[model samples]
Target: MLIKRVFNNNVALTEDLDHTEMVVMGKGLAFQKRPGDEIDTEKIEKTFITPSEGFANKLSELLDEIPYEIMVLAKDIIEMATSELNTELNDSLYLSLADHIHFALTRLKDGIPIKNALMWEVQKFYKDEYQVARKVLELIEARTGQRLPEDESASIALHLFNARQDCSRMEETVKMTAIVGDISDIVKYHYSINFDVESMNYSRFITHLRYFAYRMLRGELNDDQNDMLYEQVKMQYPEAFECSRKVQAYLEREYQMQMTKDELAYFMIHIQRVTSREKS
Candidate 1:
């Protein structure tokens, strides 16, 4: 591939014969190079092949200015969020957020101040990321002579969250309403169980499942809030209860660990939640 454009010393943009823009990753792709130059074939480490021409063009525009390393990283995360979060991001955010991180890294590399790009929204939509970004800014400031602003720091915090992507990007998020519907119909036929379960924090509980399942596997579920959840599950989801029984039995045969009551309770909870979360 040939170097189509250079962003900084380490990153550059190139195109194939198909005219597809490819972001090349490496330290020397642009170290002493310029646009229209042939990039060192040896220096290129990785490349993100865009899924479409439109995406390629948008990425091309972004690389025109942003630090190549940071913009590349941001692109990966934006793609993940669009698929996982199930919300459409305006194309501008994809461009702007990537630009913010790359430039912020540059300033941090220099002795310039780090600035937050969306301080208020960071506080509202992503408090955990905001806290991490603040700490990162403080450390960078301690090393250099500049303080990154909160909005910019918040964006950094987002990138930090984006660093971990063990889960699927396009996997459909689970919704309890479907499982609720399933549970309702099954129980109505099996034991005539009836209860109104709508308007509950089923979604939040599943979020907790992704976070807490391993902990529950390690030992008993000790969280005080789970007492009611267990009882509710038994009262409402007898079919799910049977599924939990089978899962525990399968674990016993496979893993050779004694499954606690608490573990079984959360097992049913997760199976129901996850089975439903992926349906629609």
Candidate 2:
């Protein structure tokens, strides 16, 4: 491949044989190199195929400023997260995560740590992602010899969760998580019960809330006409149905969105299963 632009001694923009733009990284791969010069294949340690030209350009700019080792560390963490979570994260995670880590390390070295305000919600709601992020902290310590605080795991978990989502903005992911936490709290307070987070029922309930929150944010309402079943659920699971009604009211009051009968039915069913499991 020929170098299209040299960002630094270790990084450069290059094009594959088919003319697809790619960012290549290695130790001293671009030393004494210029545009149109042939890249040393043996020196190319990592090659990233960005999703868009704009993303590629932004990554090139980041590579010029960030250390090559930090970029490699981010790639390793992303790979581990993908394997542990069994999900293909968006390519944009490469840039966002690397940039985040670079600055986080800088802040830690300068003794100015930024705390994650949503740490409790993140750890309670995103257990899997939180575990993966804790592992990421271990990796960072092992590689960089910098021990970031435990609260940093919540920030990293949010990044991982946001990457797994279809929403482009991190703020949207934060909002969705908050919604799930608020709704769960409503159910808990209504039933006067604590949830076993490790329970299968609890996991299923959280999953439903995540999707529901995502749909709510996108203004996707389920208007399915399930009045008959809704009535049956209300009759059979009165307490659970009442808890779901509380959740409905919270959403309507805070978010200004009303739930359809079908949504209410499903919500009540999930609440019945989860709360019954806790009670039994």
Candidate 3:
């Protein structure tokens, strides 16, 4: 590919044979190069193919200002998250995360620390992603010699979660976080048991809660289907059903949302699994 514009010795903007614009990153790839110069394919470290023209332009601007290493780090983080979560992330993560990380480090250097209000919920619901985000902070400090606050982990986890859901707004992600946090607290207090947050049951419960919260916020509900399972669940796991009822009440009062009986049946099942030992 020929360079259409050179950002620096290591980065350039080029168009593919299909006339699709791409941001290319590599060490010394554009050294002494001008527009129309051929890009050394062997030196290409990364090429971004963004769906949005506006985001592509923003990414190009970011590439011009950020270091190549920082950009590569963001790409690596995205790859790791994709593999670990087994989800296709939004490509906007490349521009959004890289830009956030660069500025986060800058803020740290300026002695300005930002706290993530949803850190507790992020850690509890998105445990794996939150762990990876914490490790990313260590990686950032190791590479940049600038240490960010612990809250940054929650920020990173939010980005990972947002990418997973292909969410369009940060507000939606925050609302999801808050809903999960509230639901978790309700369950914990209702049962008076500290959830074994590391257990498989707890992990599965959190996963359920994430989508449950998303649906609640979006006003989505399961279709009304008369089923015997709700009666069976109430009989087999009365305490769990009661807890689920309390949760449903909380949701109704807080969010003005109601759960269908079919929804409550599945919720009772999850509640039973997670709170079974306590019941015993």
Q: For model 2, where is the 10-residue window of minimal lDDT? A: 117-126
Tens-place lDDT per residue, model 3, 147-200, is 789999999988887787555558988988898888888889988989878877
* lDDT (Cα, tens digit) per residue for candidate 1, span 138-205: 65456445666666666665554444342223322232233344434443344333333352334443
Model 1 residue 91 lDDT score = 42
Give the TM-score ranking, best first. Answer: 2, 3, 1
Q: What is the lDDT of every predicted structure here? A: 0.55, 0.87, 0.82
> Which candidate comes out best when scored by lDDT?
2
Estimated TM-score for each candidate: 0.35, 0.63, 0.61
Against the true structure, candidate 2 has what lDDT?
0.87
Candidate with better lDDT, 1 vs 2: 2
Best by TM-score: 2
Assess the local accuracy of residue 80 in candidate 3 as a C-alpha lDDT between 0 and 100.
Answer: 79
10 residues in a row with least lDDT, candidate 1: 167-176
